[model samples]
Target: MRALVTGAGRGIGRAVAEHLSGRGYRVALTARNEDELHKAAAACAGETLVVPADITSAVDQVFDRVEAAWGGVDVLVANAGAGSSAPVHRITDEDWSRMLELNLTAPFRCVRRAVPGMVAAGHGRIVVIASVAAKRGDPYVAAYTASKHGVLGLVRSAAAELAGAGVTVNAVCPGYVDTPMTDTTVAEVAAKTGRDPARVRATLAAKQPVGRLVSPAEVADAVWFCVGNGAVTGQGVDVSGGAVQS
Candidate 1:
């Protein structure tokens, strides 16, 4: 299989790329950081192509490069996303736009770009890394929550549209992952609330019923399940540690 993982330089994206590569898929790792992409490619157990580009604006170019090299992508993990925390009334226009651009629009563009090739080839898997916020609201992250919710909607609709084409579209929604991104969130919350960063992180982890933060590898496992299962389309598989059970 030929797989492309966006934001593959770090966090959940890197884990997903490594997991797929270990399973014998020729993977393409993409992110805005060229150096990080090279490092991620080096860690892959199988064949890898490193393509560094901002997913929001370079969706077409990324797919073009991948298709040119590997015929077409058989799996697309749209795992590139960002989150911002702000009171609903205090959220700036720029923050909201950034959240939507990264969390929702970029994944949509990737899905749109990869679909035709998948349809032509008659089989594909697309998994978007969303959040537990997509399932339920949380305070102080209005923009992030909204963007995740929107992406989940996109997943459901796309899965319905592509079900007959041998393409599966789904989402893996996780909560409080133990990633650099979560570290940033912890710092931001500590700065805002005058609390210790460790305390803030512990509080976030406690929100999950598992009493800990989710692992990047755990989220990758969910993505793999979505990719390997044909009957699981249109679902948001929660890797949130029972935080947002449906």
Candidate 2:
């Protein structure tokens, strides 16, 4: 199978690209940073077409390149997201709009562009990278939480509409992970609480019954399940290390 993953320069996105590549799928890696995108491609075991474009930007060139390389994508993993720890009142309009564009709108656009050929071929998978905060009411991340919830809803709606076309749509909701984003969040928490960074991490971990941060590989595993696990659709699998259990 061939796959296209956004925000694939690092962290969970990079991990998914690598994992899918190792699984013998031809992968397309996309992000804004060309250097990091190439670095991610270098780690892949299978073929990767590097397309560096910011999904939030809605760049025409990005979609053009995808159509050129693969004509149609078998799997489209909309994993790009952006956020900050600002409280609702403290957040500017710019902040909220940017978050929505990156986290919610971009994925919708991706799904729209990718599904036509999927319908033609009679098989496809679309995985949205949501967050545990999508279910839990997170106080300081109002925009992010709202956007992720939107992603989950979109997944369900699309899955329903695409079921007859033999396409599965799902979202993976991951909690704290040892990624650059989590690093920034942990550091910010430490600075705010006047606690050590390790203590901040532990506090986040303690929120999960698993008592540890979720790994990128774990989240990737969940995405793969939706992609290949038989007869599954419209599911939002939680990869949050027992946080936000449903």
Task: Name the candidate that leads on TM-score.
Answer: 1
What does each candidate score in C-alpha RMSD? 0.7, 1.3
- Write one digit per residue (lDDT tens) for candidate 2, span 87-199: 78898999889888999999999988888889999999999999987787878999888888898899999999999999999999999987888888888888888999988
Number of colliding residue pairs in model 1: 0
Q: lDDT for each of the candidates?
A: 0.95, 0.88
Residue by residue across 1-246, what tens digits does model 1's lDDT show?
Answer: 899999999999999999999999999999999999999999999999999899999999999899899989999999999889888999999999999999999999999999998999999999999999999998988999999999999999999999999999999999999998999999998998899998999999999999999999999999999999999999999998888878
Candidate 2 lands at a TM-score of 0.96
| Model 1, position 84: C-alpha lDDT score | 91
- Whole-structure CA lDDT of model 2: 0.88
Give TM per candidate.
0.99, 0.96
The candidate 1 region of ten consecutive residues with least summed lDDT is 237-246
- What residue runs in model 2 are displaced by over 4 Å at the alpha carbon? none
